[model samples]
Target: AQTVTQSQPEMSVQEAETVTLSCTYDTSESDYYLFWYKQPPSRQMILVIRQEAYKQQNATENRFSVNFQKAAKSFSLKISDSQLGDAAMYFCAYRSPGGTASKLTFGTGTRLQVTL
Candidate 1:
């Protein structure tokens, strides 16, 4: 079985600051996908970024980036230049891409608070 864990239940950052959310996983499978998703108050699940297991380079999207430690099975999200709009429930997710439905397994979630 595979499981994702977000140790931080909540985090806060000032506007234009930076924050890193920690995530760890346990998976025996060598091939899988890791993702960082954001859910605003509206509760729409949006993909912040994704990393493929076979990729050695971390993934980056705009202000979002990931530090993927494959040996440690850890995937962390770093949000630079955080803004009020970044406040949301961030979830670390996993999926076996070739599996049925590409079903996503989510972490407990880390709520990010952006302050002025």
Candidate 2:
């Protein structure tokens, strides 16, 4: 089992700017998958990016990228070129690829506000 924490409950960013949402997790497992998901007004769970705990390199998806610190159990999302469409509730989640592959632990959430 893992516990994910999102320190910032809300963050505001100007249009076309950049913003970073922080997330940290506590888990005893050595192998797992960390993820960043976006839920907009429509309430759609969108996969922003993901990282493997054993991988040293961070995971990136276009303007969405993660700063994954395995040792520190930190996985943060950096949104570049922020847009109106980016405003949403972001969640950091993790899932062990073992027998509990069906389970996913998610953080509270971080409300991102993209402004003009």
Largest TM-score belongs to which candidate? 1
Candidate 1 Cα lDDT to native: 0.95
lDDT tens digits by residue: candidate 1, 1-116: 78899999999999999999999999888889999999999999999999999999999999999999999999999999999999999999999869474888899999999999
Steric overlap count per candidate: 0, 0
- Off-target runs (Cα >4 Å) in candidate 1 are none
Taking all chains together, the TM-score of candidate 1 against the true structure is: 0.97
Candidate 2: count the clashes. Answer: 0
Candidate 2 lDDT, 19-94, residue by residue in tens? 9999999999898998899999999999888888889988889999989898898999999999999999999998
Q: What overall lDDT goes with each candidate model?
A: 0.95, 0.92
